[model samples]
Target: MNETTLPPDDFHCGYVALIGAPNAGKSTLMNALLGAKISIVTAKPQTTRKRVLGFYTGDTHQIIFIDTPGLIRPKYILQQSMVTAAHSAIAEADAICVLIDGARALERGDLLPVGLLDLLRKAGSPVFAVITKSDLVADKKQLLPMMARLLEFYDFKAVIPISAPEGQGLDGLIDELRAVLPVGPQLYPEDMLSDAPERFFVSEIIREKIFEQYRQEVPYATEVFIAEFREEEKCDHIAAEIIVERESQKRILIGSGGDALKAIGIAARKDIEAFLGRKVFLELHVRVRDGWRDNEAWVRRLGY
Candidate 1:
């Protein structure tokens, strides 16, 4: 009798890192690709400060998308950590997707993602390009020039143009991604969406509500921490501390007669309820942590 050799499995699995400049819609792209809001989104730049993984399973491939903070020049220690988180993801990813703002690139006549090609080259990961927020582009002809300029960035495998919110080019984006992934076993189960702790997103949801509540300097000065997250039979109880660097900002967060805090708590509680699929009783408080963003100790303590 002759010995028989078995063929290797053809199933694919890999990490895909989304890299871009501030507010370039990397989070939006990840949510769209997963068909779920695993990554938070906001108008504020650098809203994402950590690495979040969104897992997706298809017929033959399982892709783990790593949503990292938008890469930026770090003026503060917090921002340095944020940029570091994004860079770390790229180093571990098997494929790198460079997301660029189509509107901004068209307006400036410059493709901002070209700088990322150097990092991608250094990582030795196969890179592709995507022009995000395509729906915002009024003139169709404008995209041609933007896409043409991306050639200067590198000879990308495929440069896709996508509108994440409007459901355009998403399937094609997935197909493009599937081609670059490695043949391996799925790392996560099919039913799982993310690997982050519940408190991480609880803090993030509260942080999002803060951004929605304030403007200008307030958002930049604010961060949230979930001091206690407890579960009851009928409802979840969450207490979040809003951290600011100044007493004046703390007063601004609390509002006169505590009315502003009430509003923020109300909005955040509703979002948290929806997110957890349970009734939530949320508590909010404000504290002053001077220059927390510049202090690595507080930055790590605050869960960044």
Candidate 2:
């Protein structure tokens, strides 16, 4: 059935926003929860620059999880847009899961950012303190004091520790989230994983490959735009342009004899084909956009 079709009378549905700092595993958690990778994850901070929605449909509930950009003070137009997308998610959510990197918080001895805490206070939604990457913690005993420290800041609906990769605490987290959802019909089809189109995910797949292959500022400076997507009987033809800020970065991305760009293309094409479940003829190009990150129009045009 489609999204418009009504579900069983006892079904529950609502939006849940997964909010956290950069590298806090928000994307990982969403991918884990949905059992699909709608959002890209990388070691780099701010890998997610916009809101990605994943639909988790169960017999009893449908949780629409909004994976947001990491919360950070914006220094430029693009960053400002990222922060805005996160804020917008917070406002739209019925519940908010504040993901705290378990290992990182334990090392720093801080639970929540002062600014983020203040923002959550006014969010008008049930806030959940989710300690992510529990598998990384050497001493599980340390979590008690961490949870205590977290409570000292704000009253959380629940404090849950989870390792997304191990499937630890995922069931409990789902139960907690499902319990808060309002009784309603499904907002999306049970078979539908996400509302984002194929083209958007295609661009994201290419961008993720860039993030994986490049180092330092190259990945952050680069943005992928799908210039052409054509469906043929045998395979899909896709052409993408990687936008960078400077010619030097372009030279670096292309490398001597165009080796680097070719490597990215090869890796990206494999994943893209797997994602689409079809053969793909992929094309890649690099262009200099000169301070595109700071330019408001450029940032908006790039689909940030």
Candidate 3:
């Protein structure tokens, strides 16, 4: 057995859950902090389905970030699971980062985070209000009122504004989040990036590409599963299946002359090879699972 080395005395370990509305840049912030792409991202919002852990090890602290699915009003059985997963992290985490769109907060009166504040009222964890995408705005001062509103009704440890894509305010975010953790030994190996298995990531990579390549409800209704992943001497052999709720959706994914499926495979292979640091031979199959998202048994099997 391979023994693991523990960190020296005075090390800190804690879980910080990132919670917010769709498109609030939680995954981007997580990837930026870890300095690696532990969570797959796309232009689409609500792309993350499960709780993805990104571990950051520093000199004195290790922050285990829970990149959760975006909080939304549950409309379907699948969405109910997503919202449940987001709220469940509140109890497990020592701190919470409520990321909000600075511009959206100002224009819409920050209703989403305000509604979610109820979940953290008795959480007993330090919550931080992080305003993302400040680089795109000219008036940074507009964020103050939003911060003020959050502070008025919520118990936030700090209010920080950051732009993950532009590499701004991340140091302060990391430092403050790390400061709240309790002193303990290292929770994981120093070299590990995420707690999820490689198969989970393989599925996520395929799902991310599906989100990018498809439009409208297709991305929302689709799910990807890696049925097989085997590493050979020369390359990794991965077989994945895309499941949709209807047969019509399957046709859209396969496309005319199978061009769309071919494109998805090409794009996913490139990313899988980059992520694994080895060549990957990826094969995809399409299946019609009628009402999978709505059925409790099917949703459970899909890992939602």
Best by TM-score: 2
| Candidate models: Cα lDDT each | 0.86, 0.91, 0.87
Q: Return the clash pairs for model 3, or none.
A: none
Residue-level lDDT of model 3, residues 1-304, one tens digit each, is: 0346555566789899999898888899999988999998888888988999999988888899999989888899999998889999987899999888887766766545445867887687899989888887788877777778768877789989999888999999988987888887777888988978888988888899899999998888898888888999998899999999898999999999999999999998898888888999899999999988889998999887
Per-prediction TM-score: 0.95, 0.97, 0.95
User: What is the alpha-carbon lDDT of model 1 when measured against the actual structure?
Assistant: 0.86
Count backbone clashes in candidate 1: 0
lDDT of 1 by residue, 123-216 (tens): 9988888899999998878898778778776878888899998989989988888888998777787889999988988888888878878888
Which digits, one per residue and each the tens of the lDDT, describe model 2 over residues 1-304?
A: 4666676777889999999999999999999998988999998899998899999999899999999999999999999999999988988899999999999988887666558877787887999999999999989998998888788878999999999989999999999999988888788878999999899999898889888888899998989999999999999999999999999999999999999999999988998998999999999989999999999889989887
Q: Where does candidate 2 stray beyond 4 Å?
A: 1-9
lDDT of 2 at 3: 62
Give the lDDT of residue 218 in candidate 1.
83
